[model samples]
Target: MTRRPRNSAPEPPAHFAAADLPVRDCVELAAGLASYARRYGLAHVEVSGPPELGELIEEFGLDEVHFVDSHRRPAVDIEATPRTWRCGQRGLRCLSDQLIDAAHAPPGRVATASTLAEGTVLRFTRHNRLGDALGIVTGLEHYCRDNAVASVAVTGSPALAEVVEVFACERVRYAPLSDRAVSGDAIFARSSWSLPWLDRFHHSVSDTYGGRVRHCVTPLLLRQEPERPEREDVVYCQFDARSGTALPLRSARRLLSQVAAHGDVHVLGGPDTQYYLGHDVTYVRAELPEMVARLLSCRLFIGCDSGLGHLAGCLAVPGLIVSTDDFETTWSFFRNYASLSVIPLAAAELLLS
Candidate 1:
């Protein structure tokens, strides 16, 4: 992709007013989006994901949905571990031609070529991890000069979003995927044919956000510390969900049990945490900001290779992230280590001194 050099800040909107936007109930998905765009006076919408998304957006009667392909092409030149997930798909194979074909159809704005100005704010909609989001944004800052950036994420992402602002983002729009008029199709559904989990993430980011640019990995650029309450003797533990890097429940339980024997324990995860961990431990489940606040309130954090561990890292909260062999799969692990302390699952200890 080619971009013009942006040396200075772009001109601001002529009219600006802040208004209270309410979510109104609509019979259909299109009606709700139409109401939202009209109420907000939106000129254009940049959607993150495969191009087929514009077809879904056209149902809303809006013609200005520009698609930013989220599918990523793998780097075949760089040798990687022969993992089950790295299929090494590249080029046109990684793209969604269905969306490319749709772009040429009527309603020119839908799938039309979109342009970005110097101060244009690009908001990323694919936010699932505090560490990944932050790392990719750091790469994005390299390409974006004088441009404002923001992340459109869920309530469970506020803590990381705050850190994103510190890393040069201007705003963090909190609208959970459940609330949006989005089709909720897997962003990787198109690329699943070729790339696996690790490659999909690595290359997609390099393609979409990184733009194949090389930049230095610097210490996290947190400008100011978010005010947190006094720390408590409580230990915060979050080990939920099954993923390529998540620790097994049996191992997580053994570790948390050891930690609980020394002090009061508060678990942070989905409903499953309460069921598996038993009632003896208090489950501290809340939205993102509150979740991070709770993590900050604790003296320590312990979890599997999940986003909460990444959030704990951003707060500089001492903790151990236990992961499987996926830790050695990419160079990103070392890059993230600057902000987070991660240990292999085999070597993680129940007690930290």
Candidate 2:
């Protein structure tokens, strides 16, 4: 959804910026631009940069951005373009006098430790694994909005973009996740050491809400579509996660058996369909929006430590988020207050009880 301009008056021509920075800097540059645009409600802001930057941000320009190329205005003198700006990341300073003179430089300036009102911007990029980025965005969306904390996500996939647009959540092509971490406020996955983005993000920012994002309830600023009837009475479940994070087949089957007692069960059709083969469960899957809608409409959600579960958290869908035996290390990164290292039925019984 597009934000209306700050005022009805005809807006001034967008301030143009020029940059030939490396891919990482360029992506940060775009995050800065999108962050600024979204914050100020510059409905008509225009942005143009290297071909990579253009391709990276153009689609976002339409919905989740303040930067647009519709003007095709001639480039501003290199000196006049907005410069030294930033949004989500930390410690990478740039000049922003031209970007906004009175407003603090490098937009989204961090608040001193003196107060929690850190008008920080939490950035998410599709490039980051869903487990790494989603909770930070949604958590900030939940706890920090009153402080003007904003979430900005940059993604090429319209589907993923749709997800973050709700939280207001990046990347320039070619930047190592390490470099990208500098632009956002929080990264929860402590294992970012190998991921590098997580390491930089966790180490750089101090406020991560004690790292229990899925535990904090969240709602998209935008209202969900009108509730429609779609098995609003069923118990929804998904025994899936990124590759190895999923539960074992026998455990999954046993879990489904227990869930069957709760009413009709819904599972997204996939390789795991085999888990429900002998059980009486309903297959439920669709486009991202439809999928979310279905989950929202469901009576309850129960799933593994996966994106869908986090998404269910955002929608305030009551559910169980079960983890595998590796819950201490590998699965812990995707955890919340309710996540558990029990068998499917055990996790459900414990949390639901």
Candidate 3:
């Protein structure tokens, strides 16, 4: 349900306080945020989320919502469009570490790393994956606000744009993921890889709402696959280094083999992934929808803490997330899932059991 915004003056935007509001379901969360903003007695609640979230805010009468279209990495000229930029992959020598630290840094300390030239803007675009780009955007949002930099410009795919638009950026530009060379001054690209967005989103659904978001919006976002008699005892699995570093081949095989002992297990991976995994286990290659279908029909899912792992949890499928060394706290907060730093045969056996 949408929370209609008050006709009165808006409340000052507080990302942290809004994050603490207890609500789920994108629409409800948006309304609650609007209410929170109003309670604070400020005008114009600054909000962001996945791009599609703009509609929800509009439905609630938050017309001036800062819908930041991040996700796209199209080639654009920042000189002419001074207010817009990208979050895609860009190599920054000395500024990368400082920028990442700044996303979580307090308002007072974020301006210490000012690599951008005067009158230039920072844009976020592609890192290795869309998730990576978003993580950088979260940090950049905080940094820009703290540094008194105007809104950031982000460009990418429509789907990515939908997600990024909900983020706290000033403006957004949409374009396909491209290899086009980005050239401009004061343009810092998203380089560091981490999914900080999950944490930021989670806090918004805390308090009164249940901590797990798997219930509020997962069903709407993903269609439930009908049960298959033939797939009754199968376990769906995914293991690849598509976004982050790959889990070791031997570790994955050992875990999968143990899981297979419980019953039939189906492995999911891309073309290159299948080679290292070998043919001993049943391998199924499919696009995202098919992959979702497989997970829905399976007894359980096992995979690294990548995009698929997040999806499995959101779908409320019982699963295990293999956490790598650089595991972020955000990745562990999911419904119906357990995480292990290393592959544990016992964990697999328990999940399948």
Clashes of each: 0, 13, 28
Which residue segments of model 1 deviate by more than 4 Å? 1-138, 145-168, 171-214, 217-224, 242-244, 350-353
Write candidate 1's Cα lDDT for 153-223 as tens digits: 32334544555555444333334335333321122221222332223333333332333423343334455
What's the CA error at residue 175 for candidate 2, in Å? Answer: 16
Q: Give the alpha carbon lDDT tens digit for every residue of 228-339 in model 3.
A: 4454688877887453546777777777777777888887776667777886667787655556567777877777656666656545677667654333332433322332
Candidate 2 lDDT for residue 266: 75
Query: Using Cα atoms with residue i matched to residue i, what is each candidate's TM-score against the true structure?
Result: 0.50, 0.45, 0.43
RMSD of each: 14.6, 16.6, 17.8
Worst 10 residues of 3 by lDDT: 77-86
Better of 1 and 3 by TM-score: 1
Alpha carbon lDDT of residue 81, candidate 2? 26
**Each prediction's whole-model lDDT (CA):** 0.45, 0.47, 0.43
**Residues 211-249, candidate 2, lDDT per residue (tens digit)?**
222232333443346466765678887876343557667
